[model samples]
Target: MMKLYKKYQSLIKISFFIIIFLISNNCNSQNKYEILKSKIENISQNSTDNSKSSIEIIEFLSYMCHHCTAIENILNQWQSSIPADVILIKIPICSNKKSEVLQKLYLTINEINKPYLHCELFHMFAKEKKSITHIKDLNDWLISKNINVKEFLELYNSFYIQSKSNRANQLAKLCRIKGIPTFVVGGKYTTSPAIAGDEYECTINTINYLIEKIRKE
Candidate 1:
């Protein structure tokens, strides 16, 4: 009888430890991101669409902002592994003439189906320290890239590109985006590296956490 009681006690002790371990692990998993509530703000309290399952993550950025250039690699890597339900939209903030030109340039490249040039343009400004202050400067750079300068110039000056650039500017204003590299998740919550104590990883974690939060809702 004593032997049976000892075995029963041992099993109970083992089960208790297992339960404790699981509870600890669950708590850790819930708080793994250490997301700071202050780092994110609610932009919209409106109800999200129940019919659409996908989420849109809009990134407001500008080529003139070095901070935006710095996070491109990490952002691109994260983009590559994103789930199919998430969509990343990059919008250039046109706060001035130079930025307006860059915004048009981005639209022209997309219209021409040469989206790869987007990274090349960033490399030119970030690494080469090049500036396209005038149409001539942009033409010269396009020529060096072996792109059809005449074709690019035509599209760059087209009304379609102008309209797209204008829309981007308006969207930035609507979002009240005051800084580059600002991320708006699901068009409702806004966060950034600056908001997350200038920590890129924290910003990413915040983004992922928000994504899951929206999914659950």
Candidate 2:
């Protein structure tokens, strides 16, 4: 009877340690992301559709931001491998006149269906150290790309582009986005290199962790 009691006690001790280990891992996982509150409440509240099963990962970035440029390549690579159920949306921060122009540039690129120009614009800004504070700065470059300057300018100044640029700015303000290269994962968690760690890869891991966490839920 004493032998059986000792065996039972040993099993209890082993189970207790296993439980502690699992709990520790879970805590560590949860520490990777921050549970957002008002910063992202509008995203959920304003969501008009429930039929969508795909997860959204919103990246708040600016072409003029050095950190955004630094992480662009890694982000692009990650986007290529993301699951079909995940959607990545990039919202350019339009806080100032220069950034607002860049934001319209992005919208105009989308409007004209010139997706490749996104990378070219980034390359020009980051690699060439070029500054495009005004819309006219792009006139020469646009012509070089064989893009019709008149049509592009018309689209850039159109009411549709203006509305989108204003909306982007308003969304940034609503989310209280104070820094570039920040990411909102599944609209429930917010993480960035500054929030996760100095290493860009840590931000990516945190993003992936949040994505998997949302998927499980």
Candidate 3:
């Protein structure tokens, strides 16, 4: 009886270790590249036009958000390396007074084809602690940069810029964006460095994984 009881104890210990080993392996087998379906969802059906078939990458952001500012350099580097099949689009959030000013700045700067100044604007906001909330303040900043404030104001308040800003707001709503610095891939997978385990590289790779998965499908 004593020998049998000792053998049972050994069996129990062996079973426990086996269970632990299996659980560990099962977890490791789950690919990091496999993002949760709950984390990403389909926004819309893809267009049938192959010309527009390129994977659309939309960044829902706000210039006033510090997290958005932090990813600026990473975004620039990623854009330069993006494949030809990926089209990156920036949508500024204009839900408030301050964001409205930023939306105008982005659209105006883009219209003028001076994206180089994007980093400068970020620096002004994040580092220099500039307040661009007021039009006068924005005008002063533009003048300091050698940009014609009058001409900039003319374009900034133009009907074209207003329409663009309105469109951007609509796009953000469609994406169901909950926060700034959100990256939506193929109009389905929405993620960020924070969402991707606080790893910017993970966010980038997850985007690439989704793009490739879409291409295969």
Candidate 4:
């Protein structure tokens, strides 16, 4: 009886060690972003577009959110490296005035197709330490950028900007976004680099993982 009990104990210990070893090895193969991707991809499926043909990357963000401001560089770099086939999207938050300002800023620059100017807006506001509380500030900044002040204002106050702002707010609600810098992959799942398993790395990894998963599907 004693010999049999010893054999059972040895077997249990070996099994436990084997399980631990496998998990450790797997962890070694994984990155933080990969973990976030795995969490989402495990529950992935086809939805809106009806075939799961492409991966949807939505950066749900607000300019007023300092953390989002900080991570903008990372997103910018990640976006540049991504291929053209991926459906990249940005939803500017519009829950309040600050968010509203940011969204309007987005549409205004987009309206003119001045992407370079669009890219500089955030740096102007966050890095240069400028206060963007009113139209004058934005107007002055645009003028400084050599953007036609009158034309910009005409669009700024136009019904188009208002409609776009409302749409942004509605889209945000639909996505269930309550914070800045939240990201949703494929519209079925949402997370933040801060709240997700990994911060910015999660965003990049989610893109990579979904790219692989979609290719497989």
Candidate topping TM-score? 2
Give the per-residue lDDT digits (tens) of candidate 2, residues 1-217: 9999999999999999999897556445356567766534333222354415667788998888878988888999999999876778888877667788888888888889988888878888889999777656789778888999999999899998888777777777766677878888877788877776655777887888888998888
lDDT of 3 by residue, 1-217 (tens): 9999999999999999999897555333113333334423333244553435577777887767788788788888988998877877787878887789898899899999998888888888889887688878887888888998889899999999999898788777766777778887776567776666656666666677777877887
In model 3, where do residues sit more than 4 Å from their true spots? 1-51
The Cα error of candidate 1 at residue 121, in Å, is 1.8
List clash counts for every candidate, in order.
0, 0, 0, 1
Q: Rate the local accuracy (lDDT) of all candidates.
A: 0.77, 0.79, 0.76, 0.67
Question: Which structure is stronger by lDDT: 1 or 3?
Answer: 1
Best by lDDT: 2
RMSD of each: 10.2, 9.5, 8.7, 10.0
Q: Provide the TM-score for each candidate, comma-separated.
A: 0.75, 0.79, 0.76, 0.70
* Candidate 3, residue 196: how far the Cα is off, in Å: 0.9
Candidate 1 residues 60-98, lDDT tens each? Answer: 887778878888889999999999778777888787787
Cα lDDT for residue 206, candidate 4: 54
Cα RMSD for predicted model 1: 10.2
Clash pairs, candidate 1, are none
In model 4, how large is the Cα lDDT of residue 192? Answer: 68
Error of 4 at 158 (Å): 1.6
Model 3: how far residue 26 lies from native, Å: 15
